[model samples]
Every structure is written in C-alpha cells, then in structure tokens.
Target: MPSKIQKLEPDRTTIAIGLEGSANKLGVGIIRHHPRPDKSSPKPPAEILANIRHTYITPPGEGFLPRDTAKHHRSFVVKLVRQALKQSGVSIADIDCVCFTQGPGMGAPLQSVAIAARTISLMWDKPLVGVNHCVGHIEMGREITGATNPVVLYVSGGNTQVIAYSHQRYRIFGETLDIAVGNCLDRFARTLHIPNDPSPGYNIEQLARKGKHYVELPYTVKGMDVSMSGILAYIDGVANDIFGGKPKYTDDGAEITREDLCFSLQETIFAMLVEITERAMAHVGSQQVLIVGGVGCNERLQQMMGMMARDRGGAVYATDERFCIDNGIMIAHAGLLAYETGYRTELEDSVCTQRFRTDEVFLAWRDD
Candidate 1:
C-alpha cells in the first residue's frame, strides 16, 4: 500500500434521555457530548452529539384536572418521545439509558411516563434511570448558568424553596408551608375574572403592569417557611366585596380594575420569595444565589432577586425560559450527569410516590 488514511470515530455519543411528565407538560430530551469514543481512540474536538428538548403542553384549559392532564400526558408521550429522538438524529438502538421522572406528581401522570420509558428501555435492551423532579430543576439551573453551590430559590406551582447544596444533598433552608406560589397566582387570576385561556399567569402579568397601588396582602413567614392559602382567602374576600355590590373593579368598567389585583399579587408573592431567599443567604453564609423553576421565569421575580443580589454583594443567576420552565433539556442534561455517574434504576423499581425527597436519590438518578 502506498498511502493509508486513518478514519476517525466521533468523540461524542449520547447515552441517555431525560423524560419529565409531572403535570400538564411532557418534556422529552436527549443529551449528547463527545469524549474519547473508546480507549483505543483519542479524544477529538469537543462536540455536542445532540441536545434536544421538546415540550407538550396539556391542551386543556387552566383548571386542568389531574385525571385529564394524566390522560394528555399518556397520549402525548408516544409522539413527543419519537419526535425528540428523531430530532436528535439518534437511533433508538443507540440510546444506552432511558431516564424518567419517578414521583412527587400526579400518580396517573407520573406512571404514564415511567411505563413508557420502561417499555422503551426493555425493547432496546438499555438500563432505566429514574430521576427526582426537584433535583432536575436544580441541576438544570446549574448547567444553564454554570453556578455551583449557590443558594437556590426554586419557586413553582408545587414548590417554593430557598435551598443550599450541602453534603451531596440540597438542603431546604426555607420552603412554602402552604399553597404554592404558582397556584396562588392562578387562583388569584381566576378571582379577577381573567380568562383561563392562553395562560392565566401571563395575562395577569400583563394586567398587573397597569396597576399602581399596593393593596395589602398578608405575608406569612415562620422560620423560613411561608403560607399563602390564607392570603388567597383574604384576597377572595376583597374580590367578593367588589363583586358583592361594594365598590371596586366592576363599579366603573376598567377603573380600579383587575390589573390592580394582579399587580398587588405579583408584588406580594415576589416579595415573599425575595425575603426568604435573602434570609437563607444569611443562614447559609453564601452570597451567591441561583433562581430556578417556572416561577423564577417571572420577570418581576427576577427583578426582585436582582435587588437582593445587589444588597448582599452576591450575583443571582436565572435560567431563561428554555431551562427555567419544565422542559426536556433540563431533564436530559440532569439525567446525563446521573447516568455517567452510574446511576440506573431497575424495571422493578416503584412507579408512584406522594412525596419523594430529592436528596434521597442515592445515585444522582438525576432529579426528575
């Protein structure tokens, strides 16, 4: 042979997928990166084989009941999973692991994703990995912003916590003792007679900007834990006064309107998060703060955190909606780290749990 050119193998490969189906949304994601393909092959250029994330929103309206949402999740999983894999340009046989969120969600919905992943893993002869939903949020925050050991303020429909990572676990320095932040926002929006369509929260956020007064809302915080249910009751009382032939909103068309209520609600909730997070920073003795979760996507909340960060000489990092909200990428990214760390779940693993602690996952299983 006069000359021979060696063919090079790709340095990167995708070995895992992260699936999140906690509620009304189903996130399917595939993460890929390059390293030495095998011991015989030298590491090539750093590359991302594929990092794909897709979301399937539950089609039903705001008051999406659990049963219907679960049904939606089941129906959409087949399509979304296929789409994610296809978009990633990864064949089913190439996936080394299938990771799915295991619990802390509606049982029917959680089981739907778990069963789907199980079916795929069994068919493809790959290992199954179950992740924690909350930890997924945290890790996604880290991956997006490159923040490590920052105080975490996670606010969402089901969770509101000021957290710190310590001893291989996320510690809850503070958390919601009552109704979640997003739930309060939605319920308050309903009381304002706002349309449930097109996302009541965004609509409320729009209307809130038009508001210019502080209508007092209760602030409940006890040793880093807060309650919002009573605030809802009290706000409902105010709104009922306006509706019960009193004097507000309905009296003069748009004057003194729902916008005021929305603005006040946002201010109240955002302030609570800021206060608790600030307190946690002091408690943890760390100046860096990372804000993650759906509620963290709120502009007003970001502004509030920004203010606190300035006060403490600390920087606050927030994920764009891409990673902030429940999405497949976060799950995939988190799951990849878990899988690489050798965390795998057996098919016999349980499907449903009411409250699964995030730190309890022994293998990093990647928070679902």
Candidate 2:
C-alpha cells in the first residue's frame, strides 16, 4: 500500500529519470510528461514529456559471469547516465523520480544498477522506484504495439517464460524448468563452432537459414513447460553434417543440409512457443499476442507468432531492438507510469535480488 491516487491539474511539465540494470546492459532514460489524475480513476492518463534509452554491451566472454559483468556495469553506468540525460534534454536536478531494476536478474548486475540509482537519489534528493525487469520488458512491448492484455512471451538469454496479465498482475502460464531458449541457442552456436560475432543468436539464425533438410531436432514438452537440452544435444551431434569443414559451397548429400536443419529447428522451437501461447490465450481469454525481450527481435519467432495469431483470428505484436532487446527506453517508460501510480522505493527497501518472479509484482503499477 502506498499513497492514494490524487487528482491534479493536467500537467505538461513533469520529467522522470529511469535506470535499468536487469542484465549486463545498464540502460538509463529520461521522460517528460504532463501530470494528470489517477490513471485507473475516471481521470485520463498523463502525456509523456521526453524519453531516452542507453545500452552498454558486455565485452566478449563476460556476459554470463556475474563478477565480470559487475565491473562492466560499474565502469560504464555513469557515462551512460549523463548521455541519456543530455540526450533527453533533461536535468538531473529537475528529475521528479528515479527508477531502477530490483530483481529477476544476475545479483551482481542488479547490485550495480541499484547502487547507481541509490547514489543518485540521495545526491539529488529524489525518491527511488524499484521495478521488476521482466515487467519492464512487457510494458515496453505494450507501449510499442499498443496491445492490452495480450499473451506475453518473454524470452531472453537468462529467462524464458509465457505470461499473461491477470488479477492485476502478470501470471506465468509456462516456463523452462532448467535452461532458457536463448541460452540454448547460444550454446548451439558454440557447438557448431560458429563465430560468436555480433550476436550468437543472430549467427545461429543465419546458419539455420542457409541450412536444408529436416535435422530431426529433439522436441521435449511436458504439460506446458519445454526442455531444449535434448534439442541442443541433437543439434550438436549433427553439427558436422550441417556445417562442413571448408567454407566453400559443397552440395554433397541430400540427407542433411544446413538450411534444412536451421529451418526445422526454427520451426520446431517456434511451434512450441506458439502452442503454449495459443494455450495461454485460450486460458486467459485474450486475443492479442505480444513478443518481448531480447529474443523478440528474431524475425522467425515473430513470424511464427504472427501465423499463430492469424490462425486464431487474433493479432501478434512486437517491438524492434529499440524496445524489445533490453534497452533503457522501456525501463524509463515503465518507471514513469509506475511513478505516476504513486509507487516509489525507499533506499532501505532497494535491495538487489537474484530471483524475483514476474507474477509476484502486485497492483502497485497496474491500472484496472
């Protein structure tokens, strides 16, 4: 329970600073807006003022290691913060509130973000708001697609789950019991000895596109949960067939080709997701479907969801890398909305957590 929603004049001059530290990416944003009454009340919502997003990519071989990620975050956060503020044309002194991710991410990365926000909040005398990272991703997707109450599929390197809004909170309908989908993709890329350039996920997708023949990748599903470890093993076993020793194009055997494996893998994985999403939509009574998080940028994934939505007479939505792939703007957008809801975190309450389930966040930031 927090402050009661109160009515105020149509505000045209309010700005909020947002900090996102859920993953290795340390993002910061500033948003300007006009103030308004309770969004859930009879009053309408406020207008946005200014918005910004910044992401600091972790150096190679440092993404999953928490200690190394901490160093990366601490080193680049201050500069990024100033850059986001400068780009938004907003002053830290005038920032009405500060927000940062509190959990559902690496503990070291979370601590890095929390410490930065807490330090700034104390120095600026601004109230701090702690937000759930996954929730931020979902809200950002909603803003990008204008999809309300859609079945949300959150897929990232560290997390993968199917979710939908219910009872004033996002409820997890299905998730991986052991490993995430993105993690599997990255590991598969490693098995194929693909250059981990740009992004491993993208690299795998490209190789999959050139591949031909159904590689018969494993597909394991129990109820609503999926296990991709078997699929990874199967793909590794067929690596030699999919990727040849020389770089030259050699069409030798029709039994297995890179394009076929890639196509089959993408189709199988996407079908699993689509199956669960359709089930979740049926259960939630929602027609809209939204894809968010880092993996949401995959065109193949989006296409699968699009086909699923069309089959169900629904609509599928997703944001590009701008909002979908772990950025500062989404964090800031979600933070601004939560701040308007009268949600702020005291310094003592702002502790970084290794595990914060998405469904656990209450109605503090939601509107009826």
**True lDDT of residue 343, candidate 2:** 71
- Candidate 2 least-lDDT 10 residues: 1-10
Instruction: Please report how far candidate 2 places residue 144 from its true position, in Å.
Output: 1.6
Estimate candidate 1's alpha-carbon lDDT, on a 0 to 1 scale. Answer: 0.73
Top candidate by lDDT = 2
Give the TM-score of each candidate. Answer: 0.86, 0.87
lDDT of 1 by residue, 1-368 (tens): 01112222444465577788776667888776456668677433322333444333333334667777778777788778778877778887777678788766667778887888888888888777677788888877876676757899987777788888776778878888888887888777767667755456667788888887667788887878888999889878887887777866433354455567788888987888888889988887888889887778888888888988888898889977667777766666666666665566666763657587765655332232
Could you give candidate 2's per-residue lDDT for residues 70-137 as a string of tens digits? 77789888888788777766677778778788877888878988899999899999888777889889
Name the best candidate (by TM-score). Answer: 2
RMSD of each: 7.4, 3.7
